[model samples]
Target: MGIGARALRQRVRTAESEDWDFSEGRIFGSMCTQPAPAAVAAARRFVTSNLGNPGLAPGTARLEEEVVAVLLDLFHGPAFGAGGWVLSGGTEANITALWMARNASRKREVVLPESAHFSFVKAIDLLGLEPRWVPLDDQGRASLEDARKAIGPRTAAVVAIAGSTELGAVDPIPALAELARAHGVPLHVDAAFGGFVLPWAGPAAASVPFDLAVPGVTSLAVDPHKMGMAPVPAGVLLVRHREMARSIAVASPYLSSPQTTGLLGTRASSAVAATYAALMGLGHRGYASNVRRVLDLTAQLLAGGRALGLRPAVEPTMNIVAFLHRNPVAVQTWMLERGWDVSSVSAPSSLRFVVMPHATRGTVAALLRDLGSALRRFPP
Candidate 1:
């Protein structure tokens, strides 16, 4: 007395249809986009593989290793002694990095900027560590002078952001690294959104040092699922030295691997395969092309907003753009009513737009039309 596979498929499709499709390009609020076709196909092929027990899925484990190696190289980590793992996402990666820092230093305080991602809040709470919050400057970047004041004997780590969540602000990582080095504390860079985009973002981004190549950076987190066009739940954590990761390893007697380094025990290997596929298929030139395309679209969005008499909170450093709005909540509601999904930020009271890969010229034009209408209705 059970429904057959055909009926189940039909019912699932019917339910899924009610959700917003990224292909339609109305999902302006999300960091994720429609995954690359090659990545999706690769994921389906390895759906049954589990990387947690490497003994069981050796092929998938090797793929994960290759993915990590490529990402480390991209971040300019040392070729041989560096270590990395593919975790669930940025939150887990951030927590794991902080946990390692706390354990290694045996300290309780973490120095971070106000613009850091909310994931740091969870990490601090879970690890029983105190946070020394640094204020942001007029440009929304973390104040370097304040950060120097915050670092002290009890500081376990210094957290810098390469790409912040709400404002897409890239903190001055090289200077922060110098500060952390002076204090003898690990500096962790959360580059979840910018890691992939910044590498190919042309000359402006080239001058910023936000990776392991910078002297004092100990660990860094980047998400392949964000700008890499990979499936969700694919985050990479790269450490400057392999021994730094040893602080968090726990023995797993039941699993094929002697120890598990990440928070999850049964991780989906499909994500690993998809990440590898996306990285290999796109290569350097392909990603550079994609980044240029999105950045161009971002410029269009900014110009369109300016034409509507709306000003941006800050000049965008990445694909994410935000406009200063008097009534952000009302504008968000108005857009939602018209089937356009966008987000709002509280710090500067702005409406946010993330131009992911799914967003095209046509979609951006449509969104601007609707946004203009919303602005007129709300008079923001």
Candidate 2:
């Protein structure tokens, strides 16, 4: 029905030696089509062998509980009786969160920043709720003032981004939370990019404060694929109140044999197992340190960009760096020639780089070297 497995496998099998990487549905650098390590391999084997969801066995369910607990604890949610569930990706997590928020609300409108992920609009469309655009500040973060203006009683939810897609900006969550609380409305944070990464990379690194620590933040969407560095489909949807999630849970006759639907339907157990393995592979200190690596490298890359007359759209809050250029097309062409996978922003013809965990200082240096040479050849 949806993009089926046999077709996808054939497509991927054909791309085993492609020149560019495919991630988050985009192809840019050479990182895509790379093979998995042994942990991922082992997890895949286990998943295929198991007939059902991770609910099929003690080992799978135990690992699931462990992964959920660790994610819940790290994101500042209550460990006692609180719940965390996995999804296909951030899109699924965000859709579910949006649906849950909409179901909990008495209003019909959802307000989000202009730079909110496209999936939010898609989710809004799917949920049949009206979406209002909240303007962004000069710094590219969501405008607290605009959000305040947008929040009338009819406003069902105020969704703030924890690391926006375009500029890598973060909305002021504490400030946004205050506004949401005053109006007695729930705030959904789409930390799909920033969530797992932010607990390790804090306010000094992030443009805004996030996590369950923000009282008015009703729910959060986090992806373990990005900064969590797990295999795909390792997205998480966590709620501040377990009761709120009850609005979305419905009984199904399909679950009669298993006697449970558990939150989402028959999800892939391999993704859960991969994330569980990844969390253990990169524990608390390790995750924090890996995040720090990307931060430092982004800062490093931006420094080089500056010498070539580029400036941050907003100073990077995390591993993402965005800069404006009069002619991003030309610069992009130059970068592509040098084996870089940066994005050109259409909003203002800017350039943005999402520094992956594997992007080392050596990689940064190589990118800078090519950039410097290109800038000299074509002054923009």
Candidate 3:
């Protein structure tokens, strides 16, 4: 016998009780965060609407167009031409961009930074393209010299990261763009994390330039669900020229639309509406304020870590801070025991904290207190 709605809801809640306590503000291991109120409301309004076939669902398609236009403006690209589409977060966006590169170029090799997101590796494997990995410089950015050495006759594309997963490093995007342009190769910037935060980072924006303003940037990917605080699975991949996207397009005969722009046949237009609402609601000033606060919290956390004798893996340019500890596993266990959510990095044997909107100052201070106590018990 099937259970009633109330009973089913109760059972689901009981199962979800084991999850992290978002209300207590202890979680700091990932980019995921609670959606903004405006975005949530927008999603609720359009959750049942699908824009899979723009010709059939004209109204939903219009919402998607507005979302894309807003995103292009945010990324410093042209609002006209609508040279991009919303997809299912970073993985799909990255794969889609790589697929375009693979088809557009004669060569089958992609040169990427060692610090590039793992999604690129997945794309390389899936697309049957060779990976020419370039090492990072001392500052944890893709080394221009290394990139120059790595790219050769078979180099189809060069990939750069704006916000690296582990270190939160911003590659020298303009330099990479220059190199790619000179070699007649396409440059794709994976700014999924930084794309939403970096534009309004105030003085910090001077150091990071992974955007459409850079002349040689052929394509770019961004995730509205990350820093934009939109609902999940709202990623966008943009091409500088419309022809680049058309090169990888497939014919879709059955649908009202003649061609399919993305890998999936059916897509949630609710995500696009929510993303558009987020961008419009937050505006430039709102995001700048949010990013500024996160930066302050990050500084406080870094100071607290240093006080406990923890060494930072890199000087963070973004909200993510990774620090080296003697025993990361033990630290993680101790934090978990105290009801404080924390995570560790494998390569540097370190702990990482991502400062999001939920990680308030008071919660961060409490985290520091807990870390101090944990360190005293398990010293580095």
For TM-score, the strongest prediction is: 1
| Candidate 1 lDDT by residue in tens digits, 1-380 | 68999999999999999988999999999999999999999999988888889999999889988998999989999877998988888999899999999999999999999998889999999999999999999778999999989999999999999888888899999999999999999999999999989999989999998999999999999998999899987888899988987888999999997888788899889989999999999999889999999999999999999999998899999999999987898999989999989999987989999999899999999999999999888876
**RMSD (Å) of each candidate, 1 decimal:** 1.2, 4.4, 1.6
Compose the digit string of candidate 2's lDDT tens values, residues 254-311.
4333333234566677777877877887688877888788789878888988977878
lDDT of 3 at 221: 90
Worst 10 residues of 2 by lDDT: 26-35
Q: Which candidate is the best by lDDT?
A: 1
What's the candidate order when arranged by decreasing lDDT?
Answer: 1, 3, 2
The TM-scores, one per candidate, come to: 0.98, 0.87, 0.95
Model 3: pairs clashing at backbone N, Cα or C within 3 Å = none
The list of candidate 2 runs beyond 4 A from truth reads: 1-14, 19-39, 49-58, 79-81, 206-208, 256-264, 376-378
lDDT of each: 0.92, 0.74, 0.85
The regions of model 1 sitting more than 4 angstroms off are: 1-6
Looking at model 3, how many pairs of residues clash? 0
Predicted candidate 3 versus true structure: per-residue lDDT over 129-186, tens digit per residue? 9999999886678999999999988998999999888888899999999999999998
Model 1: what TM-score? 0.98
